[model samples]
Target: MQRVTKERCLEIISRFEPTKEGREKGHLGIDGFTAYLLSEECDIFDEEHKEVCQDMTQSFTHYFISTSHNTYLLEDQLKGPSSVDGYISALKKGCRCLELDCWDGPNDEPIIYHGHTLTSKISFQAVIEAINEHAFSKSEYVLYITNQNLIFLLLNIEE
Candidate 1:
């Protein structure tokens, strides 16, 4: 780090100095002024002189969340492959929210893919399992899952 010499401090304060008429009679000289400016009164590193925030509480609206759309698509929206890897990747990268486009699949199972397009489909169950396994690998914050679908499929499974 560069050292702050008396000459440098004088040079810096000279620009802000008042005109001859504005200066008070027997006012402080350059050396005295520089010394005063560099004293404890002007030292930002003085811990006891710093301002502290007494109220640490913050409203939920004050926070910004990180989210992603079409989180199951690994590449381009149209031709990408829908896989649980996408969800895992997003979660590991600190995405607090993920979007899954769901649709009906074979045997009445739900699958995720880009609807009305050529994107490959992935098992919704696999995506959910992946999320459960890796959701907290990178961060301890809550993760929200939002599905985009015309119909919600209901199923019963014993853990």
Candidate 2:
């Protein structure tokens, strides 16, 4: 990590009038300002502020998450094609949660595609495999999969 010098820190604080005055008055410097920003009085994280400096032990609901819907559809919902590339794309762009709409295919295997429409289908296993390969490439958090499936046995799909 690059260290912020006092000059650089002062320059940054100067953009805001209140902080600039505090720095000019010599009441706030790099170390003091950094400590003040992290202090409980700042209320940066609210009730969960302690978790900011420590490993997170809070429930997942306590945090905001980036999510995407119909993550397999690359284009129009009704007429476009579905592909694992869409999932890979969303995951690469920092989507921590994805929605996969699964439907029964003509073959024994389950496929992913938007249902009740004319969308093209992609192999469900292919999407899962793509997700497995790319889920953690951009993020350290657990990827949440919201599987919406029709009431049918999803067969011949491997992990």
Candidate 3:
């Protein structure tokens, strides 16, 4: 792996700095940083379309990658039913990116569910299995699975 040095970091910051003084001083303003973050070099869609040959400079809409949120929910994210079939359905619908929420479950097994809601939990293993079976069914695009890791605190009070 290539290690990032201070000089390389400064170079990257300067590339995104809007003001000449900030660039010379290796300072990244909020505007410059936000622009850098929203740029194609750091965009997931651009990363997935690395093989495509086109004009490098374009708006975000130029990338037409489809994505899904709460992929395991059949209805509302707050109180919907979660199932492995959701993953299958989303993949079949040409969703190249799927979002999932994972939390600690019984017996140390991780499960997928919408926390603090009525959404039912589905086995993380089952979701993975479903994805493995249907990820490439609709398109040859690389599938990006984004999972939100949750941490909880249990409180005990004596009245």
Candidate 4:
């Protein structure tokens, strides 16, 4: 992202792109964009972007949350299955903002699922439990659980 040139773009895409097809086709996709954005070469002057930071005691607002839109979907929006795996993966990766699209489920329980046509459903309790297990495994930063179209579940944060 420093300089734009045919050679530089190709080198960046080829090395950072997630999929072989994208790397082969020489196009920058979302995953590749994220990789490049978080890569060291993205901001050579700023050492905070590196994997291991010298200081992590700064305020949450000072750093990017490393978040995503729909955290419970493993695949595309329409056909993906929602599960706690998504939450676990994000939490382990130090993602701070996680979204839970809760809806009234059978027997008075809340559930998380895609907002698309797919029927992927997982208990909201399961998602919360997973978060509790993994939220502090990576870092002690605050985690924001954004609930869409339903009651929110903000956990007890001790930091």
Candidate 5:
């Protein structure tokens, strides 16, 4: 049992050949084993994201990456402030959903943001564009409920 990096996870997935003799029966991305090692060897998953006194369990398949700091990262790159790069990075990281805040804007523009004070500005359409454009390797899931029309747009948008 060992920790699983994304590359290592991919490697393990690659070895799951159904044609193999004894290896023909189940999901083998090594999640439970990896979690056991982390819990026993190092106190890694010992925090709130772990479990206690029970058979080991591998968690959900999806990875949740936060987009809060994305704005700052993009801002850092610009040496000022920007939301563009962060929005792009979140999509690249395969974010299943984004928690955003929006306001009723002039000319029916659904302005997306996190707070009353605008640190960076992005419209609902911009977010959709980024997600749709990155659809090739993306897992395509809910964009969450922040803006209803945007969510509706996502639902109706065909592949």
Candidate 6:
């Protein structure tokens, strides 16, 4: 059998990271390993991406990808990923796929809330700072992944 090398391992990881399942918490650590990749390149050791992906991956294993019916009720009403909760809930209830909208935030933080609600009280930097502090706690329910260009606007009304 061919021995797995770091480059070969990275090649394997690159394929998995794009899937919703690969991004899940339980699988994140174990799944990123390739047959012969170095510890540094493994997703388990990448501090920055791990920070953002850890929490969001919490329930990924149990949850199946699905769509929400309520989205049609608010299709024209809400904008961006803010509708994820409704869709996530619907996915839990049995929806198969979902559509999410996204918008840019100050400093490109990608606020996932709908519309311009965050524009008044906080800036993207402030939100990132706050998330840095609180995101890992049990009280919060967001997974913080960095996007190169597009910003996310999530709405966590439950909080």
Best by lDDT: 4
Best by TM-score: 4
TM-scores of all predicted structures: 0.56, 0.58, 0.54, 0.59, 0.41, 0.24
lDDT of 4 by residue, 1-159 (tens): 345789888998999999999999999999899989887677656565436564678865677667757888888788877778988998888787788888888999988887556859999898889988888787665677777654343454656
Tens-place lDDT per residue, model 5, 27-128, is: 443554454345444454456543334332443234443333333234433334445456567656655455455667669997665454545657767766
Q: In model 2, where do residues sit more than 4 Å from their true spots?
A: 1-55, 149-159
What TM-score quantifies how close candidate 4 is to the native fold?
A: 0.59
Residue 94 in model 1: lDDT: 77
lDDT of 3: 0.78
Instruction: RMSD for all candidates, in order, please.
Output: 15.6, 10.9, 17.3, 7.3, 13.6, 17.6
Over 1-159, each residue of candidate 3 has an lDDT whose tens digit, in order, gives 179899977977878888998888888899888988897766767565446565636853577768888878888977889888888988898887787788899999999998889999999998878887787777665676776653222122226
For candidate 2, what is the TM-score? 0.58
Q: lDDT of candidate 6?
A: 0.40
Full candidate order by lDDT, most accurate first: 4, 3, 2, 1, 5, 6
Provide the overall lDDT of each model, using Cα atoms, as 2-decimal numbers.
0.71, 0.73, 0.78, 0.79, 0.49, 0.40
Question: Cα lDDT for residue 103, model 3?
Answer: 88
Clashes of 1: 0
Q: Which residue pairs in candidate 2 collide?
A: none
The sequence of per-residue lDDT tens digits that candidate 1 reaches over residues 1-159 is: 168786665554553345453243434566656665776656667575234333325653465767888888878988877778888899888777788788999999999999999999999899889887887777655666677543222222236
By the lDDT metric, which is better: model 1 or model 6?
1
